[model samples]
Target: MEKQFVLMDVDRNVYEVDRVLNAQTTNIRSFGSEWSIRLQRLHGGLSDGVDVVWVDNGCTRLAILPTRGMGIWKANVAGVPLEWHSPVQRPVHPTFVDQSRRGGIGWLDGFNELICRCGLGWHGAPGTDVTRDADGNVVSEQFLPLHGRIANLPAHSVTVEISDDGAISIVGVVDEAGMFGGHLRLTAQLTTYVGSNTFEIRDTVQNLSAGSAEAEMLYHCNIGRPFVGEGAKLHIAAAEVAPRDSRAAEGISDWPTYTGPVQGYAEQVYFVRPLTADDGRALAVLAAPEGDRAVAVRFDTSTLPWFAQWKNTQAEADGYVTGLEPCSSFPNLRSFERQQNRVVQLDPMGSVTFEFAVTVVSAADDVSRLVQEVADLQQAERMTVHDQPNPEWSP
Candidate 1:
């Protein structure tokens, strides 16, 4: 027998090699060894029975609570905390109360990372109004809760996805509706990418009813501790800054600076109209005292045309926090806002979208760059006095 020179299958051998090479290349490009998502359920503490999705992308870690209206429970960049936690230690589930018992400072007990999503009919205070019930019977003292119910309501149909490019996204839908009230739905998506120190929030508020609905939205992004104590500074590209009240006006000259916790410092609030860049976006930053660390927010001003700075540097026991809020309108009562023509109205089947991103600046060069940007904005226009004529109230 001739030395069995088995005829070499050239085409078959080439195809096998090509397939293996292609697979290896794809895996190398798509696999993120350091990024992962973990879903966990809490058993004790305020988080008991709460389901959280933790996303870690090597550079940043975020804990998203689906049971808490998809609000972020905690976030950190490179082991540095980025959010403020209230004195109230427990995470209260929305099921604990209905609209009657909810609203007001009572909602602040579990405030962590962020809260105070005001919307629908009312926002700032617990207002009592008379309205017709479904049966056409008049009901008096119908209460509209503080900050609305979106923050406390749980998200339905929550989904988390990880893309081949190592981006993680969490999406959910929250509904705040009643039998004879405005029907509103908030569809939210939170996204971050591997090895990146930034995270983005994209939300769409839709009026699901057949009639026009009044809505307000505010993102109370809070900062505390090392990022908000004495020596820390706030930078905003704002065209105007109006003190919300006489108290805020008292310290209007020092609005950009922060001080150590005062024994009884009344919180100061400033209403800001940010200056839009050529791209129609606005930037704000809160820097550490040393200026080595900073948290910056970039948002589209077309949708969120208003900004509020909340300074609550009272003694620690009383709570020390700073809030950078981007909103559709001032945090006034819905009735008051409507009178000012400041409230946003969504037409039947209409929707509004808001986009914002938060990023940590840790590098010295990046921090310097941010400081320069703030300086440029400060020189462009002096802070505007909050004296816009309003029939509802005067500051």
Candidate 2:
């Protein structure tokens, strides 16, 4: 088989990997395998900066990049913001859904159960919804109401490639029966603008059969290290947070009120706004402890409108972090909703395309200038207030 991605060696660790077209061998004995170090460089070629790198035993994703849920490890983006942790590793051999366990830190506990046993990573949604026993005592806990994940579907793995222009692109595909089946692709291109780093990703669904199929897609990211921490705080441009369980009578209607300086959220996910104030852009911001750098995740509300905010409430034993995810659908919850026509409809032969852009910036990056532009969008004179569609439910 042709090689898909690159393998790296920091000091002296022994590992086997294939870069682009050829298989390569490298040693990293200096940094013991126990370090949990995993990093990728789209360099030693045309670019100077590394694309995405994870350190401390994959406890943290050091750089900026897109992450799909890995079975047994926590993937972090930066130091403080987003973490993707899976304690349960998918079964390696049988390749079928069966109740089993393996001898590793990451092992499959059950169907869709990927727990993070350890690290500074992002904790995922627990599989069982509301587990009630015969006696009606809830045996299991529900993490998020509509969380969804795309794993092992035929070509569902993530792909990163370099263009001849020295620009690198990363794409994640989610399709029917992937690892090969028809899939949905979300692509991102890393480029620079006026001395700053900027990237954009496009979401497209491709049907593989002559007949039609239903498709849903989302871009999941893990941000941690260097950028996230305990003192870190989140600043969002949203006007409100939608109630995930509006069906609950006592559940607050329009449940999440946008209180300025929302704080102390760990392992919490909220459906939020994609509002552009006076100007014409929507922004989500997080301020970390170091340098008080405010990492801003800004996007064009017109393309991808939904955003989600997550924090680490679980103990470190879960190996997760505080995360702010901008997704197209609530994790693992899309399929059921789409079945009820809650998210949207897709004809067998038809497809929908959207885009999301994230810019990691410091608090001094002139956010006030961009915020002014966004504020202008809020005051548009010709628009009706109630006519507004809800800010995307998934960020």
Candidate 1, 50-159: lDDT as tens digits: 76667777789887776777788778888888767577655566665355554455555556655335554456656654444679676544556567777777765565
Q: List the candidate 2 regions with Cα displacement exceeding 4 Å.
A: 1-17, 20-149, 154-166, 171-175, 178-196, 243-266, 276-281, 289-291, 300-303, 329-342, 363-395
C-alpha TM-score for every candidate: 0.84, 0.52
Which candidate gets the maximum lDDT versus the true structure? Answer: 1
Off by over 4 Å in 1: 1-33, 97-103, 128-142, 377-382, 386-395
- State each model's CA lDDT, in order: 0.72, 0.38
lDDT of 2 by residue, 1-395 (tens): 11234333223352222232211222222122222223444433222232332323222222322222222223222333333343332222213423222312122332222121110001133233344567978665533222232332222244434333323343434333344233333222222221223445455554444454544443444444444555555556565565333231122332222222223433345556566643344666655554445445665555345666544434433534444555444543432333334343345555656555555554544545444544555454332222222334321
Candidate 1, poorest ten consecutive residues by summed lDDT: 14-23
The local lDDT score (0 to 100) that residue 151 gets in candidate 1 is: 74
Candidate 1, pairs of clashing residues: none
TM-score of 2: 0.52
Model 2 lDDT at residue 63: 34
lDDT of 1 at 353: 90
